[model samples]
Target: MKPPKGIRILLVDDEPHILQFLELGLSSEGFEIKTAPDGASAVEIAPLFKPHVIILDVMMPEMDGFEAIARLKENLSYGAGIIMLTAKDEVENRVRGLTLGADDYMIKPFSFDELLARIQARLRNQFPDLLGEVVHGPFRLDDRRKEITHQDKVLELSPTEYELLKFMVMNHGIVLSKTLILDRVWGYDFGGEENIVEVYVRSLRDKLGDKEHRLIRTLRGVGYRVDLP
Candidate 1:
């Protein structure tokens, strides 16, 4: 599918060639693209650029992607997806990036096609339902506009929470493996026992309230199911 128009992307890399390559490719694919040489510069321009997705490099001279992840996570408008660019086969780096709030990561020496696919996944994952909305019991989610209402009140959900809720709601009444959920929602196979899914599920229950988890059924050895009340 063609990317939505005016969807801004920021490419941050210390290498001039790599930066230019991404800028050309992404811009050709109909995305509004910008490039920054380092993490600090990316942060400085992010507000004005208002990028919906940021492709961040891990090892910059001024500010590494880890520190930039913290600052960007703090300052960016909600739901800005971040993808880290790391060296080939860097498993620990990938984990660290995710822990630091990156939405996804890609290894160097990757195909432009692979990177494009990941980007598309991140953007489209939000509203795989319909453009209008998805409703179940007291909760109603506006997919196109990205809003959630429970018990007639709008809930302030983080980007992760929003995607998790949508995925579960879409698959209501079926048990979904944590691995499956991680792949579909996180846009990659995390391949670790990180408790990341559990962490997000806990936050979801907390926001939706204790009684709500019954709807999001938790099987002991299995995974989660959306049996909405």
Candidate 2:
């Protein structure tokens, strides 16, 4: 499904091909995109663009991603999710980028689908209300109609199932306890067994074709969490 309209993204990379590739891909998905060849250009454009998300390359000619992030974080009055792209897979670089306020990181040779997922995840985390719809990986929830879709196809769901799925998707990255899930999805006064959550979760997994349990993860003693991207 397409994202909410007027979502702006800034792509900063030293390579022309990389910038062109991402600009084309993300623009097709209904995002307003701006491209910069290096960190200096990114820093200059970001304040005016006020991008909701910035895809920054770690290695550049004058100022790298780390320095850019520092400048952007200090200069911008609002929040923007910054994702670092680097060929290096070293833990030290990852830590440094994150330390300098990069919201996420990706290595080179990444699949477009994975990058899209990461971008969506960042939106969900940092700009949930701006999304106008709840999106987690391939799943999209239309709260206006109380409908959910996977991979752009609408899923047939019972009312309770829809509510449960909405709750899960709205809080995808967090571990939601069964009690909390029941309280939110079903009324606290409903007095149903906690295992009912298990039953519904199984049903959701089946309908979503999550036979491998990749979408909704069971924490054994804890509750479930939707782990995408």
Candidate 3:
């Protein structure tokens, strides 16, 4: 099969040399790369950048990576896996980054290949099934044909909505955590808000029309799942 495509990446840092190096390295791999010198610029351009992944540095001029991560995840389209890079190895910093919604963390002076590997790992986990047909009970999805239907009702789904439905159906019976759903359906790197999961689930429920034997079920504090009655 052809190589996976449609990867957009954003690099945010204050160092010109670091940005230049990462931009060049990742671009060589055929990923679209955008660079911002600081958190402010990253925020300003993020909507148009539409990056699936963002590599952010902890310290910057106007705003730190922590705030940037929170802001971007909240304001931008939910789900963009973010990787935090910093010189400090403090446990608090790592904890805080994750609390702020960073997907991964790396120390300063990291190898480009390692970073690329991390990005690819995130992508793989996010998009395990790029093509196929899956049928569970009355629900059916023909990915190759871009069609999904419940009892042949035919689901008209947005790209994101389709991805969410496909993932749930593929993992039928498993109560997937909102975090896992966000990373897989959205993008593993941009661990944005979890509310988007609820929103998408609601949309799917609306289209699927919950009735006697609902395919999607919530586990209260846990997450969600798709199953047959």
Candidate 4:
């Protein structure tokens, strides 16, 4: 589904390629995007743009991500979810960013799909009134009600079924491994067999009227992806 109207995003990175790539991809996803090459520029532009989310690169010339985040947090009147991008995957860097009020962090060379998901997650958390319901093709998930509807028809689902479907739909178009699904849908401590995922998938497919396996595609060696236009 298209993003909510006027959902602005600020992209701050030194690399032109990264900024261009993110601007193109995020613009296609229906986000109003602006780019800043350095932290000072980001700080200067953010007050004017008032973006709902900011994707910041850790390494920059005049002001680094940590300093940028601190300054942005102090300057912005409204809360903007900040996601830090860094090449270094050290624990100290992650801790520092979070301590400085960054909402999330990502490593360099990340999946575009994953980054998109993280952005959406931030929006959902920060602006629930705007994104309380998630729509993907025919399906709509009412996050507040913990309910799902397809084509305006509400489906009766068990608690676990609802959680599983929510996870799949929220991460639509991305292949999810059975291990990941199990851990997310079921708990990591769940001692159930891996085949439990298959059982739930079959149940979900049946409920979704996916007799031909068109909605949820199964990759034999990989995992499952919810295919929607």
* The candidate that achieves the highest TM-score relative to the unseen native structure: 4
lDDT, candidate 4, at 58: 86
Where is the poorest 10-residue window by lDDT in model 1?
125-134
Q: Write the per-residue lDDT of candidate 2 for residues 137-203, one digit (tens) a residue.
A: 8887776676899999999999999988877876667678998788667865878799999999999
* lDDT of candidate model 1 versus the reference: 0.80
Candidate 3 clash total?
Answer: 5
Candidate 3: deviation at residue 187, Å? 17
lDDT of 2: 0.85
- How would the candidate models be sorted by lDDT, starting from the highest? 4, 2, 1, 3
TM-score of 1: 0.60
Tens-digit per-residue lDDT, 45-133, candidate 3: 88987887899998888898988998899877647778899885666887799888887777778877557656754453344353245
Error of 1 at 125 (Å): 2.7
Which regions of candidate 4 fall more than 4 Å away from where they truly are? Answer: 136-139, 143-229
Index of the highest-lDDT prediction: 4
**Scored by CA lDDT, what does every candidate get?**
0.80, 0.85, 0.78, 0.88
How many steric clashes does model 2 contain?
0
Models 1 onward score TM values of 0.60, 0.65, 0.55, 0.66
Q: Give the candidate order by descending TM-score.
A: 4, 2, 1, 3
List residue ranges in candidate 2 displaced over 4 A: 135-229
Q: Which is the winner by lDDT between candidate 2 and candidate 3? A: 2
- TM accuracy, model 2: 0.65
